[model samples]
Target: MAITGTSSFSVNSSPVFRRDVTSASGNLKRNLDLKRFAVSSEQATTSSTTTKKFVENGRMWKKSGEESETARRVNVEESERNGKSLKDYFDEAKDLIRSDAAPPRWFSPLESGSHTRDSPLLLFLPGIDGVGLGLTTQHQRLGQIFEIWCLHIPVEDRTSFADLVKLVERTVRLENHRLPNRPIYLVGESLGACIALAVAAHVPDVDLVLILANPATSFSKSQLQPLIPILKLLPDQIPFSLPYILRLLEGDPLRMAADNLVKGLAPEPTFGKLSHDLLTMSSYLSVVADILPKETFLWKLELFRLASAYANSRLHAVKAETLILSSGRDQLLPSQEEGEKLRLALPKCQTRRFDDSGHFLFLEDGVDLVTVIKGAGFYRRGKYIDYVSDYMPPTPSEFKKIHESNRLIYLATGPVLLSTLEDGKIVRGLAGIPSEGPVLFVSYHMLLGLELYPLVTQFMIESNILLRGIAHPMAFKRLKDGKLPELSTFDTFRMMGAVPVSAANFYKLLSSKSHVLLYPGGMREVLHRKGEEYKLFWPEQSEFVRMAARFGAKIIPFGAVGEDDIAELVFDYNDQMKIPYFKSIIEEATNGVINVRTDASGEVANQQMHWPYFVPKVPGRFYYHFGKPIETEGRKHELRDREKSHELYLQVKSEVEKSLAYLKKKRERDPYRKMLPRLVYQATNGFTSEVPTFEP
Candidate 1:
């Protein structure tokens, strides 16, 4: 549920509720109410319909929304959950707890939204609450790409932890057998995360992706230590334990919810309004205080203890690709600290932290699971993730978010953009570049690739174009050695459609007629020496021209200069190599990083990953110029000839150098190229006003 919305939404009492229990491969035998979690925000809604036919014990039950009421349910539910809020989850969970259900079952929410034909099966295992409805906030977005199934372990059901694992394992095995090629996603939270891990441990060889939020594996060391003794001593009929249980869960559910609600709110917030909402929410949670009464509460706590022990013991056996989402303010567990520990423990694992979030990370207002998966480049259709195919283009909201995140970078290095049309007329923005597909922008990578944010964001904001950057493998690959911490910055790059650099990916981008951003100079230019600023360290051979010509891509040779203006390289890769300590660190860091240009010599082949220490200067402006697009439509056959390809490549390189020189020279004439003048100009006018740049 998002706390941030334009209009208000309220959860009414006496809402519809689904039947108490379900059978395995659950059918709607009870004419259940199957309550839909309604939205408490004004977010836009979208729907999807699952069309795959089912084969149950050789009997074909072809249930599809295309010809049935399934589609209607999807529409109705999606619209209802358009902007799910914390209250919706509480309401649905309250309904589940109130119903006297038995046994654990897997059920597909007919309204789980639609998915692609090749969408992998995503089985959600619920947290301690055991309703499996924890993903209510993320249901609509997750539905867009995953065939969803949710595991419901009834609050009243006293299923042992081992049996729970068996049930999930059985479901995983059966699904894998049916769709062997597709990777099943195990989206788990807390206790559910433990179940997912145990299943992964049991089926080590199976293809699976685990997305665990606030995993309870660290429960043994949490503040819940005192609860274990109390839980064991409590009698079955101790109805007075709800407040104690809630206390162990967190300090105060109302306070926690209220504190996190105003975070990331839209259109700003007033303290007075939030205070009123906080009071109202406090009353709401109190109304349903005993959702998990004595017996069920004790059962969940015991399950957590057993599941944690079970999963932690077999950590070595679990081989599935795992993403751990750790919340910083998680009072129930030390999730933030545990994330770092888990990253080292798992063979194939990565962790993303939400410092402001709590134990119920998924249920929190600001968290978006789908976006996190996409940013982490975890979405895939088959056994392997093809960065190019799995890349999800950023939505308007995402683009704006990315821009705002890097806004300081923009202000720190004020960017001035210029592009040339086919007629050689220079324009202030992207107006001169062709607004079409298959356009390859080959730019000189500025120092540390500092120009990237400005370039990518401006292209999206100014020209309404998305630049699919060909990036380094470190952005996509996880280094198991833990020699260097994973680059969290790359998450934004992946979110903005940056694919790992590879010959195949380049071909895929061009073949798909997508706009591609390439840095032919690669890391050689990005992490250059003290004196190599604005210098092109491109490969000796024409690696990209032939491929670009084959696909008839428009190669736009561009240049961005001004790294020297913002900072001076006090220590570089060359300097690091000279010192023994730094050299060892570099070797260890790049040990697991992908080897690029292994057979090549010269500066262009130097693909070592190292951060050059630099000293900041007075903030200066960055200048970018895109030269005229070199047409390759009719020159494919011509470029197939080696001489022609090399000739064209050299021509592109020369143009890039020319643009660099042009920007270097022209910026000298601009009065507001430096920070102080630009600030003064904007201050005199409006801070939101665009400071003037050199005349195009």
Candidate 2:
């Protein structure tokens, strides 16, 4: 269980870790070799047909052509379509059983899809296991974001910790020199995480982003005091049982395998295949003794002790932006506590807690490192975050997870979707809605923006349209001290295609022929007082009409009602202002963000942060109405007059009000508008079945 191999002890001054590697890399050079695969993205991603090889076990691991790579991917995909399950992971590691001897080297995993040329270089520092394939299942996905290099410290390789640091630092320095604009990523697990921190401490100036999973930097010898002796006393026959013991430390294999099936029930054949795979994978687990023998186990334990101390000392000098992934159920170390300490010690740090996950997070079933990175807003091609370009859309799996998580909201509030046709006939479903081009949907902000998820999620599900919401500027605001606002909470907005409200962003989105969702009422509408539900607090100006005309976009006025039915705003901004403590915190948070409404006039211009508390009512149905699309296509030139454009703006506003009026009146006629009837209907049908609303 000792995660000790990759941890390096380094002082403030970067320790020199150079050694003559000519003998070790001779076999690599003699075979077909060119630039040791790719050090970073630009160099690594070349013509698709060309072979990319890296040295593994004194052999050139090569993929000759596209056909072979495609076939390999097909087989891999068929075996584990969702992701590499626990069984597949064990099967992949079976090769380590032979106990072959070799030196530490880099391996570039094969990635089928095309990736950007400017992708960052991601070097994975191994845990105590030393077999760098810990990211085995994640390689294909990570390959799209990074030109991956796995540091494999051979089982019997006697390389010192300092020397290993030197070797990695050497590669880092060389890559940074070649692609000065690109940032390098260091992904480490446990002992590997400590090594990554050591590198960051030594090379503080390099543009490095560290993703550490259960770093052992906060280790205490007392924690391992009980297990050390028992590990050393293992007799020769014990190696056969090593896999059983290690699997206990690793995680529950059956539970891990079952995680892959969480989406739904599988066919009998699938379960039968899973059972067969489990038996096959068990034989691979027996290779654990070969990978980490009793002698090695005892050595790693002592090494882990030293690794912990040195890594602790080096934390002060680390300047890289760090993301610590801590597991709540980690049996090996107090990773959750270590993550907190690291967050406080490091200059810029963020921690993500996987409460249900094990110590080996990357190997776990539910964990997707790439999705985690996106959600954290840590994935970047260069130095600064270009909120628009660097934005990664939700993967199919991510979208599914998001939808299923919010299934309750769907069940509680049976949404009534109605759209206007060309003839002005309102109909159910979005059949009347246009699918083409630069479309702008002007909307009202439901209570605390409760209508957002249903609106956006439905658009994505029903029409395959991603409504890039024009989010309030506060969501993208930075702190006064110059540190970025916390990533964990706000970055999800970015991941879901929410751009900070700006004229420039609007223009860009329109120019790209995208569907832009805008809420003119902004903060004032969402945070309005108790009785102000469904009221438009929009500023009186031609803000977006002219811009929509410039792009000849279709402006659709949409309204959502039923916030009052779902929750009652028991406490609002007026109520909070009566209390000094809540009032001051609200003012401070609001003042920290840049002032956007300084020159604007009216009640809507009083833009401020308001944390309104709500008390849930019996769930009621939500009703949505999309009015007839107003075309600005050929009117671009005619609407140039200030009076003409302003007039058009008022027309759009009236339509939004009309839609609101339509939904409010119609929702009352629905039979299952209240919670009791809806629940009864769902009980008869299915929890996820769409409950009927009022006839359009």
Candidate 3:
């Protein structure tokens, strides 16, 4: 027999069945007794027919005057048993019943200190369960910051995808009227994400921002599609219940519930140590099983049809600024692929892939998801402005902070001597370099880009200019299907005016007359294999040279030698690949993602490198040398010639090599070249360590 509510257990007699029934029944009875007694003391509140039905079903009805005496007796008994008040048990019981509801549509408004008529409204759309109960953790936390509203669709209601869209549109309009000037943010999870997209497309001039987590766009193509055919064959009213069949179809309901609970409670490092809540597990499984049998055949068919329709829906109408949180570990759908598809279709879209999170990303990583939302400029207060076009350059205060932090690294790594070449002669410090105009510093990347901290900071300090470094796309992109890497460095990179290496961004920076740093070697240089240190792995194309000539930008080729001083390469990519487990991990991490080593050719092809494998040794001094500037001014015509551009590229590459050679030779003659002398020198001098340099 199908379990409807708490009353269904009264009909079951099997021993195994009795245990489950008794657990839920006992809890309900204890709670009702406590609640009935409380009601006896207080005046009876007005009750609806639905409340009366629930009371009758739970067997909690009582006549008028007897409640007070019964309540007093129950209160005394409850106090003796647990020394807790009747109200505490009543609340717990209420929560249990609330959670046990089949296809729950209940909404308990969260109290928020910042909630006001003017606060930005956030409407949350839930997954296929339609329960809208999983995001309790998110609601409690985010509600304090933004006005939160969760959509609850009753299981009995037959709402089409189009109907759902209309509902969302109407809700957003109502909220807009309440706030008037504030923007609305539609947050969707799985199926809800698809609904939000459809709503955004249908509603014009709504000015909504979408935050979608593990959207169910690939539901039609997923493994769940096969089950639809089987569901169709089943009779509308079968002789026996289909809960066991549904459980098998669902695949390990207990495990699924346990996984979600564990992830929600103790994420990442504390992953599996916590014990599973058997009560919660029972409730979750029972709710799903109960809802499946009750849902009409037509409703089940419509659900599948709606999902299929949404999978193939046109997304071009979605013009709102959208932030997609695609979980890499999502098993229910191909979230990463779907996110990319959506990103391509939408005009303004940013997709972040969470490598470690599953389909229930909001439940597992709510805090990080909220952090990403705030970072996307969706939660700004007071004024409403278009943040997409607003370039976030570092303020003077930020610059000072970065400068001071880098200063410590500079002092620790010995003195950072800045020099430039003039007429093929080495000139110490910034005196030889030009003071103005758009100048691009094309530098050879050291291992892990360790030279960046010293190079960028020293240039800014001495020349009073910030070097806007062009970074690898991976640096800005989230880790694919893995735990979040350190975000502080990425944030710092952005604040210090770092942009992904793109021709469009490069042109924009040059047009603004800013000092830009370019590393043509890219990931090839950073993830270089053993014996590839200080080697240039530049691509054959001379596109940057042609672009630089168009803007009359000065190309300053620079190089540094210091990675070898700080660490030694004990293992390389070949060594990593030899181990089967390690190889699988590397492949998983880089699946469908492009890296320099993925399809390397020429000098880079010979390296066959992966991520850098190094063992730290005693730290030694770092050396940097800048080559004479190659003026691209009035050389646009020369750069336009493919042969001339190739020649110019060769000249820049040669100059960078010269700087590397100069530093390598000069560093050998320096007194602080070895770590021992540098440490001794620092100890003797207390705060400062002087290094003797040789003339080049």
Candidate 4:
């Protein structure tokens, strides 16, 4: 006969079956009789009809009350036998533990009045035969001070591990739709810990993960070999149920009842009889073990293999904040040192040790356990998106999109220097000077101008800042206004995070948090005389003094050393006025036009290889040394003091010259200087050149 909610049993017949009890000690009457009975005939008939409605109607309270009535019996007996207070037993045990065995203690529960639902959602997982009942009561005391959610793990293969994950995804989606958005936390015990880690790997949104008494390191086929066969065809002899089959298959009914009780108390738990409740938990585990598969030896072996793999597996990499809680005094798992080893492997994770508690710390620590888990910042649903492959900005298409959207304009507003040391060598670079004040940065411009790459690389990687600059009219014409179709917003490259400001809003843009780039040298820097390779050519009409004075910003002068040495900057200012041949050449070269005459001397200027290149000095290494920050605030009205601003600008210019000379000397004997050809074309501005090979 099938039995549900087994209530009370005679202590004379069963030493193992124990109940968790509640009592009104020092009251008028102490004698209260306990009895076990199945649901009445009429009640049984109504159960099926009521089950769905009851669950849907928030009848968790009813379910827990019923379960608790059954679970409390053993505890009542323990209190009577011990006579002393339950707290005294725990306190005594706590004091006697060896120093080496002490595990970390759970955090004390915050006062109920101090709790808020704004806390993140935390999911709890129980070990083998772990029903969440008892823990739920403890959690309730905790939930009063923190919001928490507990879920039941299916023992039966509702689906394979892969399919199971999909199921969880669906559940999460459903829950998100049902509730407000929030982050979620996950805490798993033993086997559940493995599942939790697996879920974290797949679900990037998980905030923190708590593991309890996991046996991953020591669990192998040998440990599970005896039980594998029955697992393959679970509930063996189901249709042909017999007495013998039942006897061998029965598990701890009381413990199972206790698990149900814990789950019922979700969001809050009663922890007065915590120790007695824990002792009774072992019975439920025993029952769960019996019903698990154990038929044929081969099938059992397969089950064991699968279990071992699942337990041992780990996420390849995790980026979310995480916490690992392990018990040094655990009976099932090895020493907490095993957890330490796992922590070492996951260098990014935070960990806490509990020496006093065993595998079931949730019971031992009770309300404190809830406090610790809740503090890690758990979320339930709707707070964050599921792990999307496009979240990282490194994805190629995403990166492309962001670049297109951000429109980083390299502005050159000064005399540009270009040079070369030999034939077939091109050398070119830029020096940027910024005006002090939190004003927008506007420098020079280059496209397919070779020097553009080095300038951008220096600003991004070396300076570690997202730079924005104003594009020349010609540069904008080629860009076509960043209107590329077939781009995804999910892609990081779409530059959704960047803003494309115009010259009309230049002042407003300068007032923002962007580092503006401008090239005042314009086309004048590209046109060089035959033998004058390294020369600064400035435009007659430049906006430097006007912009610095208007914004009251300091002028930070930076020099581009090798830019003039690369290739002759080929362009015609009147191309827009219907100049056919020159316009076509400009168009071709601007769009990566090649085969044009290369500046032999300009090539030598690129030899100073740095990161991305991994190569040492080739021709010359570009250096961007930031001088002291200039203070130019409140000078906006001092427009007539042009020479005063110019003097400060020259000081910046002098500093740039000093830094350039220092970089050149430092790279003179670097190994990359030996690999001439590989340093340029193959490495693209020598950004990612391979390190030069050396002869031993």
Look at candidate 1 and tell me the lDDT of residue 76: 25
Worst 10 residues of 1 by lDDT: 3-12
| 10 residues in a row with least lDDT, candidate 4 | 52-61
lDDT of 3 at 625: 81
Candidate 4's residue-wise lDDT over 200-316, tens digit each?
566655444444444344445233444445445555545221222222111222343466476785322334344354443333343333323233223323433454475456555
Error of 3 at 189 (Å): 17
Best of the candidates, TM-score:
1
Which residue pairs in model 1 clash with each other?
1-84, 1-85, 18-34, 48-114, 49-114
| TM-score, predicted candidate 1 vs. hidden true structure | 0.87
What's the TM-score of every candidate structure?
Answer: 0.87, 0.81, 0.49, 0.31
Candidate 2: which stretches are off by over 4 Å? 1-82, 94-100, 111-114, 225-282, 473-492, 591-602, 634-642, 682-690
Q: Write candidate 1's Cα lDDT for 384-418 as tens digits.
A: 98766665566556667788888888987788889
Give the lDDT ranking, best first.
1, 2, 3, 4
Better of 1 and 2 by TM-score: 1
- How far off is model 3, as Cα RMSD? 18.7
For candidate 3, the per-residue lDDT at 583 reads: 76
Provide the lDDT at 201 for model 4: 62
What lDDT does the true structure give each of the candidates? 0.75, 0.71, 0.59, 0.36
Evaluate residue 11 in candidate 1 and report its C-alpha lDDT on the 0 to 100 scale.
14
RMSD of each: 7.9, 8.8, 18.7, 23.3
User: Candidate 3, which segments miss by more than 4 Å at Cα?
Assistant: 1-389, 396-412, 421-425, 478-489, 592-609, 679-692
